[model samples]
Target: MKVIIAIDSFKGSISSSEGGAAIAEGIKRVYPDAETVVLPLADGGEGTVEALVSGSSGQLRTASVTGPLGEPVDAIYGIMGDGETAVIEVAAACGLPLVSPERRNPTLTTTRGVGELILDAMERGCRSFVIGLGGSATNDAGIGMLQALGYRFVDDSGHEVGEGGGALARIAQIDASGTRPELTSCTFRVACDVDNPLYGPDGAAYIFAPQKGADAAMVEALDQGLRQYARAAEAHLGHDIAGIPGAGAAGGLGAALVGFLRAELLSGAELVLDSLGIEAQLADAQFVITGEGRLDGQTSRGKAPLGVARLASRHGLPVIALAGSVGSEASALNSQGVSALFPILSGPMTLEAAMDPKATAAHLQGTAEQLFRLIQATAGASS
Candidate 1:
């Protein structure tokens, strides 16, 4: 049998390649002569840089940049084998995890580091980019990133406004005269999964700010500031992007990418899968195996496993998924192309123990072995 496997990282434990390798070994134990094609997969969040970098034989580069709270942070990005495309995850510089729980205020955070990283990559001769936008710790409508890129957001007195979402409403002017001229020659592809508007009840401030540490009063204030920022950009930049799908992603960073950088926003998982050329891998495969750290209701909403399953299904392949744990809502995956779900845990164990790299690899291998035993028995019965 020719089996195709594409598994995402188990985050904090095994990486995508390690997990797929373990499962591939397990399959070998069952059918020693079987052909197994293993591929890396990710939903385009924390592991995006590692996934794309490793898969495409890219080199990683690190740079010091302003963090969410204005502190200097060392962020990592990748240059693909082509040496012209840079892959970046915005969260590496301004993600929620970088802030302490008590200090996790979106109003005070900034995405300046994202721009710094981009500028550094450009200086390195990378003109093509794939930026992953999620897990941000700001509600600033991307003014901070824009500032780093040479745009000026000034108050009525012509003084530049401060950083963070709190400074949005104080802006009265946006000057693009100083924008890096090199930007005109660059191309950006934004990996964004959310389609929220810039500001409103269902927009970034209301739906996502809460997780970024916005209280009711802060959410209201941030929402208003986002509106002001959008208005200023429309008036001064001549591009109106407040209502564009995904404009609210990463606290309106999507708006900056689209309105100013002319980026094409795409589904994060779809972007990763397409980058990996998954369709071609499925062409001659008889069965596909995919998995991630957790499988839940969110899986159907463009997560990596679902991305793999959907594509495999279209090619008349049955997809089986494995996870470290399965949520109560994981059953929803059945309707979205996953034929079955398998949890790799052998039995009860502590969270930390279950997350051990060696333990996870062993469990993945053992679970695959048992699962394929059933398949082997069924195939024999049919014969």
Candidate 2:
């Protein structure tokens, strides 16, 4: 029997690689000769870099970069096993986790560190960049990243505007003389799943700023600043970036990468599966086991587990979804190629207890054994 285990990180509980390993170990207990391949996946959010690095034989590199608040933070990016592609997660540098709750401020945050990482990879001869734009704490329309890449945003007085979205209101002329020429020779794949625009009632500021510590006033200010930034970018770049789908993601960092970097924006789950070559692995597998931290209506909205199910279905393989928490009409997952949705919590427990790494790991293993046992019973009865 052959089974492929592809699962996302359980968010604060287990790494995706570990989750796959636990499942594989369980499957082994029931069918020791079962061929299992583990591919840890990410949906372009936190831990994306680690997922990619762990699944592929990749080299990890770390550097000091400016954080969301201009503090020094250690950022990591990876060169994939193929040696030509670089995988970078913007969150590693400008993520919300770097700041305390009291210090979260979207208006003042920047993607400068992301740009620095990109530049660093470019210098190391990585030409193709897979950039995961999630978990950011900025709404600066990627101005900071642009600045790091040699684009200049000057204020009304022709002085270079400082970092942060708050500076977008300044009268500006953008100069792109400094953009790296190597960028033109490279391919940029932006991994994003959200479809929000950069400015509007449904845009970045209105939808995401509250989580970044914005008050009503800050949201309003940020909305206006994004408008200003959009106007400036449109005047100079001749593209309407604000209204583009996924442009508002990561505090408008998506728009910046798309408009300025000419990145091809794609669903994070799709991109990760493609990178890991899911289709090839699914070819002869009898069953495909996939999972994530939660499964609900959102699972149908392009999450990693859904991605895996869709691919598995195409190959006529049954898919089982294992999750930490299955909620609110999670039966809807069946429509997305999931045969059954399994919640790993064995008993009533606090969220903390349910998600405890050690406990969750053991539960996952046991769940796998149960699944294979059922599979074996059904096959025997049918025969």
Candidate 3:
């Protein structure tokens, strides 16, 4: 039998490659002669870079860049095997994890590092870009990133505006004359999932700023700033951007990508799957195994495993999902193409114990072995 293992990273436990290897090992235990192909997978979030890099036999390049708080941080980006495509995760530069609870101020964080990463990639001859817009720590409407790209935001006095979301309202002019000339030749595909608008009740500030440590007053202030920035951006770019779906993702970074970079926003899962050529991988596979940190109702909404299951179903291949924890709504995945769901746990254990890399791998392998045995017995009984 030909079994394809395309599992996502078990977040904080094992990477997608490790998880797929564990499943492959389990399948080997049950069907020693089985042919297994392991493919690392992600939905363009935290592990997106690692997944795409490993899956495509790419290389990772690191650079020193300005962090959300203006501190120097090391950020990593990937160049795929094609050598012309670069994958970047915005979180690497200004993610929420980079800030402590006490210092989590959305008003002060910046996305400057993201621009640095993009510039670095461009300098290396990458013309095609896959950018992940998740886990941001800023509410600056991407102005900081724009600045790094040589777009100057000037106030009424013609002085350049300061950094952070607070300064967005002070912008009176936008000067793009100094922007990198090569940027016009690049193609950007942004991985985005949310549909929040640029500003208002359902916009970036009101919906996501609180998590970045914004208070009610700060949220209001940030919303007003985004509104002002939107007006300026529309006037300068001669296009509407404030009400675009997903314009508010990553604290309006989505809007920046669309309005300034002319990027196409796509479902994160679909983008990653296309990058991996998943349909081609499923062509000859007898079975597909996929999983993630958790399997729940949300999994049906284009998560990696569900995406894999849907594609596998089209090929008439059975798909089994092995999650670290199965939630009450996991049954929802069955209607979306998952043939079976298994939790990678043996018995009662602390969350920390179950999350250990080695333990998680062992449990994943053992679970796959048992699942194969059950399938064998069922096939025999039906025959």
- Top-scoring candidate (TM-score): 3
Model 2: per-residue Cα lDDT over 1-383, one tens digit each = 99999999998899999999999999999899999999989887776777777778888999899999999899989988888789999889898888899989887888899989988898988898889987788888898998988899998888998888788888378999888888888889989989999988999999999999999999999999889889999999897988889999999998888898889999898988888888999998999999988888888877899999999999989998999989977788898799988998888989998888999899999999998998889989999
Taking all chains together, each candidate's TM-score versus the true structure is 0.92, 0.95, 0.96
Query: Residue by residue across 1-383, what tens digits does model 1's lDDT show?
Result: 98998999998999998999999999989999989988778777778888888877888999999999999999999887789999999999898888998999988899999999999999999999999999999999898899999999999999998999999999999999999999999999989988999999989899999999999999999999999998898998687899999999999899989999999999888898888788997898888999899988888777889999999989989999999999989999898899999899989999999999999999999998888889999999999
Pull out the clashing pairs in model 2: none
- Pairs in clash, predicted candidate 1: none
Candidate 3 lDDT, 1-383, residue by residue in tens: 89999998998999999989998899899899999999899998888999889999999999999999999999999999899999999999999998998999998999999999999999999999999998999999999998999999999999998999999999888999999999999999999999999999999999999999999999999999999999999889998999999999999999999999999999888899899888998898899999998999889888888889989989989989999899999999988889889898989999999999999999999999999998778889999
Better of 2 and 3 by TM-score: 3
**TM-score of model number 2:** 0.95
Candidate 3: residue 39 Cα off by (Å):
1.5
lDDT, candidates in the order shown? 0.91, 0.89, 0.93
Give the deviation of candidate 3 from the true structure as CA RMSD. Answer: 1.6
Query: Ranking by TM-score, best first?
Result: 3, 2, 1
lDDT of 2: 0.89
Candidate 1 has an lDDT of 0.91
Whole-model alpha-carbon lDDT for candidate 3 = 0.93
Q: List runs of model 1 lying over 4 Å from the truth.
A: 373-383
Which residue pairs show backbone clashes in model 3?
A: none
